[model samples]
Target: MTGKIVWAAWHPRHGFEIPHFYDGAVAFADIDDAVRLVRTLNADDKTNNRNGWRAVKTILVRAP
Candidate 1:
């Protein structure tokens, strides 16, 4: 079935500007799971002094 895919996008950034980082988008079947991961990742980044952003995104996909 074609449906919306949930993804957790983590933005790793420097304090001043957007810093480039080799990041991978993680897909989740549920929005709750994606949000959970985003929170966990952003919290970890904060604790490690890695200032960045994280969000839950959705994309429509076609099922073959």
Candidate 2:
């Protein structure tokens, strides 16, 4: 089985655009676990600061 590539966008403090690609199976056994894993792996500088933009909200899913 091959993992898919997931794309996500992030808006930083300087209004800069940031995009990320995550390759993995989104079909986790549990939604909570999937979310947690995504959150951890997706952890970035922009999402760290309270003043900066929060975590990724819109994720572009790609099928492989």
User: Please, what are the lDDT tens digits per residue for candidate 2 over residues 1-64?
Assistant: 4444332323344332433434422343344554554465447543443444333333344546
Query: Against the true structure, what is every candidate's RMSD?
Result: 6.7, 8.2
Q: lDDT of each model, Cα atoms only?
A: 0.53, 0.40
Clashing pairs in 2: none
Clashes of each: 0, 0
**Model 2 spans > 4 angstroms off:** 1-26, 44-64
Compare the candidates by TM-score and give the number of the best one: 1
Instruction: Kindly list the per-residue Cα lDDT of model 1 for residues 8-30, writing each as its tens digit.
Output: 55455532222333344456677
TM-score against truth, every candidate: 0.47, 0.28
By lDDT, the best candidate is 1
Candidate 2: count of backbone clashes, pairs at least 3 residues apart or interchain: 0
In candidate 2, what residue range of length 10 has the lowest lDDT sum?
A: 7-16
In model 1, state the lDDT of residue 18: 25
